[model samples]
Target: MRVAYNEQMNALSKILGEMAGLAGSAMERATQSLLQADLSLAESVITEYDQIAALSHQAEERAFALLALQAPVAGDLRSVVSGIQIVADVDRMGALALHVAKIARRRHPNHALPEEVNGYFAEMGRIAVALGAAAQEVLISRDPERALRLREEDEAMDDLHRHLFTVLMDRNWSHGVAAAVDVTLLGRFYERFADHAVEVGRRVVFLVTGTLPSDEDHEIDLAHGR
Candidate 1:
């Protein structure tokens, strides 16, 4: 019974890793579409999001099955519970990517970003993709230290997000209010995508360490701009 339970747990972890990879890929393509105004790529990201959602559902079902039959305790129980939360984080990551693609499609035939601010978004997309990949690695490796490092990557994303607002708020800005609004929303999408990736890492840390990072620790991180 213990052998069977461990196999099921490992299978759940594999599914989560696959979901993370898909989420990362979705963001990559969405970024390309956003940068290049490629309607076809944007459309693909939008349509293929169902695949990620389906995987989330499958993972949730498996987790609940383990809980019901295995009666997992201690670390086993933590793994099952963490798997459920991780599923939500990964699903949200995919949804955030879908939003990025939708913005690209909405502006069809025209670039969503102004030329001056395009570099900011290009870097934001790169960081968001890297964070997603790191989240996947942590999930597979179950390394709490590696998972904790996601915070540093998330800080880089926060820095870019802050810098983007600075550009939008500049007195010399000439992109007009409509373009400003689009950029504002796009910046948020990337920031939130990175945030969710960080959340996945936190969940993995909890799964491995059996201790969730305290709210105070989280507050300290935020207070320090981590």
Candidate 2:
């Protein structure tokens, strides 16, 4: 029975990893759709989000089922509880990706980003993708060391988000209110996406070390504009 329970726990981890990959792919394609103004890509992203949602639900169910049937304790209990929380984060990431794609589709044939600030958004997209990949690695390896590194990676995303606001606040900005709103929301999406990735990393650290992150760490997580 213990062996079977361990196998189920391993299976839960595998499903979580797969969900991470799906969310990451969604964000990458959403970025392409935004930068390139590809309606087809955007449409595909919107259509495929149901799968992410479904998988999230499946993972949650497995977690609860294990809790009730196996009555997991100690580290096993933590794994099951943390798995639920991480899946929520991953699901939200997918929803944010869908928002990006919707923006692209809404503005079809015309790039969502203005030419002047295109480079900034492109870089933001890259960082978001990289962060997503890092989150996946933490889940797969369960390495607290790698998890610690995600905080530094998150700083880059935070810096970019701040820079985006500076551009919006610039007096010489020629883009109209509508464009400004789009850029503001886009920056937010990427910023929040990275935050969720960092949150997942923190969860991994907790699962591995059986120690909660410092209060300072929680503050850092909340400081970034959610």
Candidate 3:
């Protein structure tokens, strides 16, 4: 029974790795399409949503299957639970990519705005790609310390998110309504993607420590000066 449980977990990890890769590619392409105003890639991102969602559901079922069939306990139980979390986070990341694509489609022909805002969007994409890679690494290794460090990177993305919003709100900057709305949604996509990655990192910590720590005990505080 123990052997079978381990086998199921091993298979699950492989399937999840594929999902992570597809999701990462989706985000990367979505970002590129938005920045370049390439409608084709944006459309591709929208079309891939079904596969991403399917993989997430499959992951959930496999995790629950392991729980029901193997009655996993202790560390093993943690693995199953964390598997569910990892996939759900991955799926949310995929959704953010889709949202980015939608924003990209809406802002077409008008072009991206503020000139300087382009740099912010570029950095947001960079951080998002990095977040996707880090999430994959956490699932691959299940290392709590690595995951903790990954979560810390979210602070930088958050800073960019807020800065872009401030630029959007500036009365002097004339992006017009359509462009401003696109910028706002773009910022939101990056912020939410990073947040989902952080959630995966929190689950990684839980898997390693065998205890899911409450948010109340988290002591790391950001200066919020950005």
Q: Note the Cα lDDT for every prediction shown.
A: 0.89, 0.86, 0.79
Segments of candidate 2 deviating more than 4 angstroms: 215-226
lDDT of 1 by residue, 47-98 (tens): 9999999999999999999999999899989999999999999999999999
Candidate 1 yields a Cα-based lDDT of 0.89
Better of 2 and 3 by lDDT: 2
For model 3, the stretches where C-alpha displacement exceeds 4 angstroms are 112-114, 213-226
TM-score-based ranking = 1, 2, 3
Per residue, candidate 2 scores C-alpha lDDT tens digits across 1-226 of 5787788888888888887788888999999999899999999999999998999988999898888889988888888889999999889889999999999999988888898888888888898888888888888899999987887888888777777777887888898989999998888888888888888998999988898676343222322332
Better of 1 and 3 by TM-score: 1
How far off is model 3, as Cα RMSD?
Answer: 3.0
* Candidate 2 structure lDDT: 0.86
CA deviation > 4 Å runs, candidate 1: 215-226
Give the lowest summed-lDDT range of ten residues in model 1: 217-226
TM-score of each: 0.94, 0.94, 0.90
How far is each candidate from the true structure, as Cα RMSD in Å? 2.9, 2.7, 3.0
Would you list the clashing residue pairs of candidate 3? none
